[model samples]
Target: MFDKIKNIFKSDKEENNVTHKNAPKEVTVPAHKIGPKSQDDTTTYVIIGASIAGVTAVKTLRELDKGAKIIVISKDENIYSRCMLHHLISGHRTIEGINFVDGDFMEKQNATWIKKATVKEIDPNNKKIKYEKDGKEEELAYDKLLITSGANAFVPPVKNLREAKNVYPLRNIEDAIGIKEQAKYAKNIVIMGAGLVGMDALAGLVEIDGIGNLSLIASEDRILDKQLDVKAAKAYEDKFGQKGVKIYKNRMASEVLIDEDGKVKGINLGNDEIIDCDLLVVSTGVRSNIGLVEGSGIETEKGIKINEKGETNKPDIYAAGDVTGTGIWPLATKQAEVAATNMAGGEAVIEDRFEFKNTMNFLGIPTVSVGFITPPDDTYDILTYTDGDNYKMAVIKDDVLIGFIAQGDISYVGPYTQLVKEKIKVDNLAERVFELGYSDFFKIKEDGQFEW
Candidate 1:
């Protein structure tokens, strides 16, 4: 699937022998050189951020309207996937390897990319945005605007944590780079919040050599409390334990011990235990970057509020991805496509707002979780299948399969997700839920294609 999308992002520039490593930070394609603009193509689309959602929107807009003016302004100079930052930290992939798009993506789309620009203010009334790049401030006008500013990692309010040095969040490429550099010399490295990001930090650090003591702190009873149940989480936790990693569960950092140089020396836990540390990685959580639309009449609660069509309260304005607090990668891309389609005078709406589905492969163990991990009440029927190293659980309510989890072998879990998403009745198949596959729900059409 990713290979197909990557091919769509490729252009003739690849035939001309261009590489992302040598691609320029900025690319400006003349409007006249693109083609004769039509009446509908006169719209100017400006997108903020350069991550998955922003880039996906850019591609969608260009595909829908070839001659439309597309401008992508981003604070990051390099285009890389935040999800792959752990690979970068582990020295598994380079900066260019993490890029999701092709080297000539901007050039192929005929878009203008303003890299390393910090957007200071957005003026929805005037349809202009003020930004600074290389110490110079500039303003740009747009007919349609997209805010995919993404999110920032939340640093907990641990005592002295904010004021201490050698602390980082694994949300950006720079943060990963900093952690990688510091890991070479640090005597003790402690990561707070044993969520996916913190586990990613642990995964990356374990691959590197000369890393002294390593420990993980989780406020919950088990790691990945939200994504996995206790039994499922234990599978991964046991793997980490075998890697010589210390696990501290149901504990919070009460204070950050700082040396005279204002650097992190260790951490004081709520249980009155002190763990020595020279570096700390905070992976507690993430909050949307909704400050860009603060006074722009764009309604916001936990994040920038958008309708089903991804339209903001303001006219001609749309928001997607993490900026809307839809942190899931697939959902973000879907939202971007829907928003871009609407901006191109088309109609699209998000049908599936369900965000509980997630798949992860950590330490060679693949797991899939959809909907609820635990039943809200005893009214729901719970079924399980456990063998040696594999575990599977299904939560059924009435006749519908509401939740499901598969660990060790996720090969036949596709139908389970479909069952949960489509609210399919699985009364007859409840006993063999783990054995379900696409064949159970799909039939061959006249055209020799499978239809669901």
Candidate 2:
């Protein structure tokens, strides 16, 4: 094991030495060649969590420094698709279809893959972690560390919920596999939390070749209560309703009713409503995995607190992704690369990737939200136009644009959002401003119109 660890470093050192080796075999060799590669040879980047942010950051870091040693430690043996866990539950996608990258590809990067290993403790002083693999425990060291453990599904409060035999969480790949096998004959499928995951599951399940019936229980007044506002949520409700999605809102799951075998039979609501279901999928918001943070001396703000640079209060220990509570995917990955830069180079601050304004989803339902969605009173004016599935709404406060939501008709929202994000003034010509964009804002005073 020690030899292998030494080889990982040796190869890392040889990689740097190979470049200098091409200097010509005829060149005189100094007795003691003092070079950067000779001293402190290993440039290892140990990134915890091989999820979205971690994987993306590793790729970006390799692009930045191809020779760096990347070590990925994850509890799971294979990569799990988090974005499509709902798809797994709804039987839209299979486990094999989601995992694009595998073990063989990682081996090519000079990356060490540790599976089923739990990080027992993070020691910043030694720059190592006391981890347990298989049955034995060991300590691993690194020059730089990135914590991107992602998030976990919330455990709901319901009697017999924890004891239910058939009930399972659709948070991971295994959960999805279990649901697929166990939920085939489920007469009633009760899904809790009707948020994005819930809706995603609904889409996936409704398209399922099998599965009997689906029931959704949302705690809030509307589905996706956190993401969508009242009006927009209502639109989704109406659409899902047409598909036989029974929605029960403003009710909490107080207790889960089980049969004699402790198998899930029904869910009792706090409002004294009993709903029976064979399978239950709870998709509440995730809480950051902070067990590694509790005693690590790292800062915590709901999630692990790190600056835009992914640097923690403790030296050499940085965090990123969902655990960092940045809520910015692109930014978190960028932060990891920046941390790698500072670790490989010198002391530098990692800049925040982007403000928590909004982002561009690759494949989405044409929805765009920036700043505050719903404005207060008439002080914040709203101009909205809706034609069936297409909707665009903009809010203005104090002669300046404040918030906006655009769906379906978002092809023209690109330049408009750029202006808002840059805080450019748009109150001058608020009316008749739907023309491609305004030239006045760009300091284009040619008295001409937009360039199409």
Candidate 3:
């Protein structure tokens, strides 16, 4: 089923073009005066989220159809990179530095932005949306609608957690700021979940001067279990051990302890252990924000269901970003482009080629895992090379390379990714895997042409 879904989005050019590439940089435009108006129709476009996906849709739509009115409504006060929220907490970036687009992006795109606005409902039948802002309800209509509402942090239900103060879930800039302020005097910080968010938070919190004790609790035995193999995960485990970030595996937070003032005091683990801390960060996981379309007759499963063209069950409505339950940044951007292209009367489709590209760096140790890390049993031959902290692994089935993982040393990640997409025969390359280089794979032909 997964292969069939991937094949549906596979384009001829995409199957050949494998190296990691970024979407077009956001175009900076001069600011222009704008004001609110009553309901009026002029081919307006409405996008629910203002993050990467929604913003990219606006940019792509503008390029295809120049004069269409665009309006972006988001509960967030400003547009910031979700991935860079850790940078903000660590003092590596400021609010301005984390802005995904320029200050005049809405003005330049001739788009209206409704900040801190909550979309209460999506009415596909009437082509309208009901939203509330500052205790007032408002209705807006659109010719086309893109649901990029994205995802929200999923905090598990623990006793006293709801009433505990100074507890945060790192999803937006506001969350990061709140954590930063609490970290100022926090001596001990206990974080739940050992996934990407928890580890990144560990890396960022360690940089703060006063944060002395850090404990990361997770239900899994190893970090990044979904992305890394056992040995590769151990390397991170060892590194975090050296950095004084305590890792408690196979444990979940069962209770939240608070002080007399209802402030967070500590956490009680399911393993009968109590971790005393001043601040708590819940980085368990995320759930799609699909509340707006729950009863609007739009099909959804874990997220709003969409095709390769980013079209939902309803006409003139589309969905993308984390709300689609797809992969991370690259896939989100591609989905946005495809959705916007079709919305603007252009033809485009999202290619699944780059969905395999996943990379994460913790305290300067990089891990790049592409394609399936764990393949079907007895179907593929796996080759592994581990020297000290550096590890490289590859998956080959039917004489073709399918997956690659380079943990410590990620220098040849791009070339490996390219090889996977090209699906070149690995009969000759398998024997010479240890001493691999560009020449070993892409050789010069008899006519002086390079076989890429």
Candidate 4:
């Protein structure tokens, strides 16, 4: 079953500049805190969301200033990796193994962790935040505030969807747990959407041995339409087809079928196609939780609007992570760092950097995409290479290395990403396309700089 996706093993050599080598060794389980600490007389740096953004902010702030108090409030009861929830469903990793930061992260950073708490109102005038937890309202004072509330799953409007008992949305640990438990007894499962959520959900579901029939429906003509072009989508389609996951595209589900007992049974497509299934999983994208700052007079668009320093229109208030509308891992971490630095009285700016590099190991296929895989017009020079299921496409304009995609062997991704980041001129090597190597376009100098 894995042959179509799996291939010869190769050591992963792609990595970014960030490092997490010194994360706390002792792991601390997240728990609820009733309110703010009464004894702490120091300056408070309050951050919302204990996921990647919040954690990174507190850690970075702690390193810059030791005396300031850092408080992290999370609406969830426990801290878990949103990205690793699929690993939990697939049984490839235990719940404990999905910790995004080191176990002892909070303790080492000396930051107070508040769980299951929702911020109700942000009072910029008094520098106070009113929150509700466990049916009680409380207020916490802060010198600086960072909102990283993240996003919530967006479920499209479908008739009778709310009435279905077995319909689920994959967003957090609890959602993954519910889906995993339901999959045990479910003989047929229908998944909606083909984006990241749907793809990850399908990846995990296919790993379960008891899965009988799997169906995926999306409005796009191909899977991962937002992330991949036609050829790349075809590659993934073929791989998914080999796994027995039936896919229906160019159709939107109009109604969710419910049995007499109010349980999910199937779905009615716009084209009058009905897919029968015992479980329905909705993976339609997400919407940023920007409502927390909506009425507070802070600027916002699709996400909370912010400046280069992550500062909102309100004084001493900033935003980061998915709430800022940029929802990628590396960018999220960088935003957190920049927000923390300015909050700690240090000067830092979130520089505008362009490197369209993203990699994914969906199912067993190693896919790497760099720069612009799709060009708007035919004037751009496009080069491609294919070997069986392995594929590569390089998009070039004006003799500069702009974008490329390496599906199977991604060992060359690091160098390719570096070339794009550096904006190296490739006019001299137009004929030597798709051959990414160190010696092909660069020469190492004694000063550690590579000459083009």
Report how far off residue 283 is in candidate 3 (Å): 1.1
Clashing pairs in model 1, backbone N/Cα/C closer than 3 A? none
| TM-score of model 4 vs. true structure | 0.86
Name the better of 3 and 4 by lDDT. Answer: 3
Q: Candidate 1: where is the Cα deviation over 4 Å?
A: 1-41, 428-430, 435-452
Off by over 4 Å in 3: 1-41, 375-382, 396-402, 419-425, 428-430, 439-452
TM-score leader: 1
Q: Model 2: per-residue lDDT, tens digit, 98-196?
A: 553543546756678788887778988788987788889888898888888877777766678888977776667877777777778888988888766
Model 1 residue 118 CA deviation (Å) reads 1.2
C-alpha RMSD by candidate, in order = 5.6, 10.5, 7.5, 7.0
Candidate 3, TM-score vs. the true structure?
A: 0.85
Alpha-carbon shift of residue 109 in model 1 (angstroms) = 1.6
Ranking by lDDT: 1, 3, 4, 2
Model 2's lDDT to the true fold? 0.64
Q: Model 4 Cα displacement at 390 (Å)? A: 2.4
- Listed in order, each prediction's TM-score against the native is 0.89, 0.81, 0.85, 0.86
Q: lDDT per residue, candidate 4, 85-173, as tens digits? A: 77778887776666655566687778998889999988898898989899999999999999999888888778988678988899888
Cα lDDT tens digits, model 1, 1-452, are 01112223445224321211111112222122223347465789999999878887888788778778899999998877676688888898888877877777888878899999988888999999999999999999999999999999988788999999999998999999999999998989999998878888888899897777899999999998877888899999999899888999999999999999999999999677899999999999999988877677889988899999999999999999999987766567778878888887777887667777767777888787888877878998888889988998888887789888888877666677778878988656666776676777899999999988
lDDT of each: 0.81, 0.64, 0.77, 0.76
Instruction: Look at candidate 2 and give me any clashing residue pairs.
Output: none
